[model samples]
Target: MCWKTLLCCSLWLLLLKSNENLAFKIPSIDFEMLHELGFEVSIPDEPGMQRVFYMLQIDDNCPALMDYITESNNGSWISRQKTSLQNNDKLQISVLVQYNDEIYEKSETRVIINARLLTTRDGRSQSITYPNGEGECHAYLSPQKQAKRCKPAQSIVSSSRQTCQGELLFEDNFSEAQLNRSTWKHDIRQRMYHVEEELVAFDDAPRNSYVKEGYLHIVPIVASEVVEGSFKLGDRCTAVESPEQECNIAQGSFYSIKPPVFSAQIHTRDSFSFKYGKIVVRAKLPKGDWLFPYVMLQPVSTYAETHYAKQLRVAYARGNSHLQSNQQEDISGSHLYGGMVVWPHGRAMQYLKDRLSKAHYGDSFHNYTMIWQRDKITLMVDEEIYGELYEGLSFFNEKCFIIFGVTVGGFLNFDDSVLAKDVKPYLNREPRAALSFWQQRDTWAPTWGKHSSMIIDYVRVYAE
Candidate 1:
């Protein structure tokens, strides 16, 4: 029994010593293999020692597109290597096993996979090929493991085409150094009749409107001097007020407040107009408190307004006085109330109020699309449809132009009363708290500098 035990111990030590000197053998690999193939190494399992680990490393010469995986259990280690070789490529694989803090490295194996191209119904294809006949010719094996010679086929064929949502009718990426005068007009005027008075005087100044680095930047700045002429107020106010108080009054073109803000308003009223199309404006909105950014569509004629007036008269005759008042207010032609609108049919307007929570408009650029077809008008933010209006509205059938601008301290700007009712929950319930926040800024410079910019990347019109 003593002799038998001695023999067993000697055999175990010999086995361990042999394993230490053992070299890793190269495994056969087929060039035509579609998925992962397992290359394994066998090691002798010893009784009592520390945990064992195995690792596989591919040399740097391997193709940048190839990937691999490795695993180990008991005394066996495996490396699964996969590649869709369209070109003839060579790879060097090496394996290592560690036990009792001692590592054993296998001899590196060189694998030569031949190139082949497979085309599918989709329009995507890849190619792989060896530069020259420098590498050995390995037999291509089928999925059934049958050895065969791979014949390089002719050029691959694919049948696929690109499609667009609509035909592009008008596109302005603002690539020029200046605003394209042929397609846009700088609307220089002050709006006087809205709920919250606009504090900025619109002007043709390049400082307020310019093109830079492929973007149209419409900025608002503190006015230096009062504008020197008298101009007519917006038509809505003119229609509502008495002749003495409304329409064509002689007032300074300048804003009412001292050192008032100045901004730009540009539109395609005369240069371009469309009846029905998909309008897309890629823009980054202004961020300041009380700032209003608008991208609007308005009628080019009074046809819709005339029709709405007749309808209102008919409604009033039927004793629908409440609707007459509401409709009058609704179709007031106030561009401030919506980003996109089929005016006179005010219900079709897209207010963009719900989108305030989805993302910070001032932080990034977003695509605002208004698709106006014969039967429907859909509004989308970043390809996500947020609002839609079906047909049957006579107002939307007429030609309409586009307008883009930024207004500050307008109706959207919360005063003490509005802030108290709406924003009080967000603030500390103080009515004047919101205004006080802006007052804390030095000379109100930060308000204009940090948060007052409306950047338009591009505007496109697509037709069916």
Candidate 2:
């Protein structure tokens, strides 16, 4: 070996040594001890722009990867690198593997990094409760067995006297022959009934109905026997454009009674409406198999003349036409335009029997309450909140009145046999279903309170 040969051999040896150092090597990373394993992340070096990072490592030897595929272990497939890892200049790789490059029988380490910010507070924080007691009194109602946890409906009258000094903003007791003249008076114009285009007298209906037993009731019916099955109910304000339009009342027995009967409905449309306040009622509901009992609340200023046609058109255009169906499956028939209100204010209506399971409406007295505050309306049955109004987005700006009545032919529209079972305690015998079947089949027409009586225990309104 001469001098040149020695020099060449030395250079080759040095190059080989460098290559050995560059070959695949197991990576080492800091998992920060088990207690410090929580990871933190920020936008990679570039705050407002996008960035990427990369990692490099060798494989290791072990059994199949499944057993090692866990948060603590990486098994065979190792996480090599993330494009833009930033904390320290050096890449601190961390991972476990069983086999290396499919050749080495020993374990190998690999780079591992969190892709996004690691929020250690993932669902570990408590919810903040903002105390808001000045709004209104709230209660809940449900069809389940009488709820055990509930606030009772009290006489807010005395409290109001203390709160407002007995000015008597509104007050009513059932013993009077007529509603208190001081509070206000509302006249619900008689609904127009027509056969084809000719105006007809729905003689059975009474004019200027009154409140009794602390409940406002109305008897809406068509009297003449011949026009009984043929007449229709239409909105007076829009009757010209919608002559044949049917209201939302379902076709069935109003009460279990026969023809030549009366039904009642009295609303505070003109006299009064409340913006933010509490309305409470203590009474037993009528629960005929097909009876429909409802507590309807509307934006007094926004929708006094809202018609069924307008409601159906909007509901239909919004792709909710199933509301037209009186299928026995949907007991509330609320999906129908009847219950859909411009909310921030909505009404609560249900099949009387369906709500209390086997207990009919009149079986036991229930304390029903509604608390309207700002943009929220909470409905309570027996003091527990059961339903709510979260739409409309409007708060109560004006005062509204309460209408409590028993109507016939709601969602159930079942035969008289079923109806008889629901309101058994109140009505006489079962109605004749065969005579009403064809009448009930017409989906476009809904009839409420043909021959029913809605009694009331008490009605009270409060303001805080």
Candidate 3:
């Protein structure tokens, strides 16, 4: 009887010890210390990580587990190497969720690392709770004997681009002292029935498009300033297969004399086109009333009558410092806009607009960027991303070529309901749009000042 009683007591004590080890809460988890170390875990989302709160500092008796987790650099652990006072930062894994029940109920709120440091005779324990709470994971790394690895249903690679993933596909420093004609084709087409309804006609004149010092500048000149009366482009026009009407124009009635403005427009429609990648453009927006400066991507094979249709705008800004939306908020050179537009099967024009406001984008150069991926697209100005779109628009799924230009007096961007209508000369429906715009030049021209050029420093595209 005494022997049996002792056996029972020993088994009970062992069970108690086992429970204590399993109940171990996360250690070295002082948020104050984390702040002191300048180490951050997602109380909120960070770039590249959305709602993921993993960044844990823990001491491990198991060096094998620590090394595997830290070195893997994989999402299975969601970890990074960090430090503590004793420098006992063995493994980094974030466990405690902020515990928002409502958010957790809707989507995945947490991924637990159940590091069960249990005593095994072999010194390797099994634990590493996956997202779905399966029991297959073990503490030690096993090569052949492992969990099920699943492959995605669709291929992520794009068929149009043959470049290696993450490779630099295209880059231009604009330091050559001239536009690389092989890469950039000047667009000097006359605005007729099937072109942009802009008030300007692009031309290849040296003053309108040139490389000065090390920068590529696309400057806009008043047609009346370049020529006292009607201007003639003649054969210097770069647009191929242009019609005879493109040769000359004389100021006349409401069909609207020659284009009131002359600007430089350039694109890489033939030299380069890609399916999906990241694009970065360093540029300063032109500051001039009624002027439009844009960095965008155009469909290589398809064409849209509206310039903004079926295109992805990296950065677009109106030169007017006083323009406002129907809501009365300023929407001019002070604001940077980026978006993707699609005319969905003539159903309706569908677009997603993103805007960021500062004192003025023209005051200094800004980095405009677009990250185009298989599932998402992100637009950013400098360090701040102001726009994102998911797999909603099919227009973004195909290949596109890069385009940079400074255009003038397009009615779609400058809305009719703008509060600055007193200064705005032409509405979208005006029959003689160009005539009305030129007639009001007295009110808008002075605002152009000496800042009537769009300066580009560089453009780069990278494959994803």
**Each candidate's TM vs. the true structure?**
0.46, 0.39, 0.63
Please rank every candidate by lDDT, starting with the best.
3, 1, 2
Tens digits of per-residue lDDT, candidate 3, 1-464, equal 22123224542233222232232222222222231122322223222322222322233222222111212133332322232111123343433221211111011112112111212122122222344433222332222232221211221223442453335578898888678999888877555322236778887789998887778899988866422465566667554443455645665544647677888788887788887777889888899888898688878765322333577888888888767776778787887777775666643243555675766777788889887777877888874678788845566666788888888876566656554565578765667666777888888888887687999988888655
- 1-464 in candidate 1: lDDT tens per residue? 22123224542243243344334322322123331122332344443222222222222322222111223354433323332222233333333334444444333333433212322222211122234544312321112232221223321111112212233457899999999999887765554333234445566778889999999998887544433454344533213233333233354422222224567777776766666656777877776544566576666663221212111000000001111122232211111112232334433232232232323456677777666666655656665665555633454445676777776554323233333343311232333332332344343444446546789898887552
Of the pair 1 and 2, which is ahead by TM-score?
1
lDDT of 2: 0.32
How far is 32's C-alpha from truth in model 1 (Å)?
29
Tens digit of per-residue lDDT, candidate 2, span 353-437? 1122333344455666555555555555654555565554243344454544434432222223334243222222224332342
Scored against the true structure, residue 432 in model 1 reaches a CA lDDT of 34
Candidate 2 vs. true structure, TM-score = 0.39
Looking at model 1, report the run of 10 residues with the lowest lDDT sum. Answer: 312-321
The RMSD of every model to the true structure, in order and in angstroms, is: 19.3, 24.4, 13.3
What is the C-alpha local distance difference test score of each model?
0.44, 0.32, 0.58
How much is 428 displaced in model 3, in angstroms? 2.9
Give the TM-score comparing model 3 with the true structure, all chains together.
Answer: 0.63
- Clash counts for the predictions, in order: 5, 52, 0
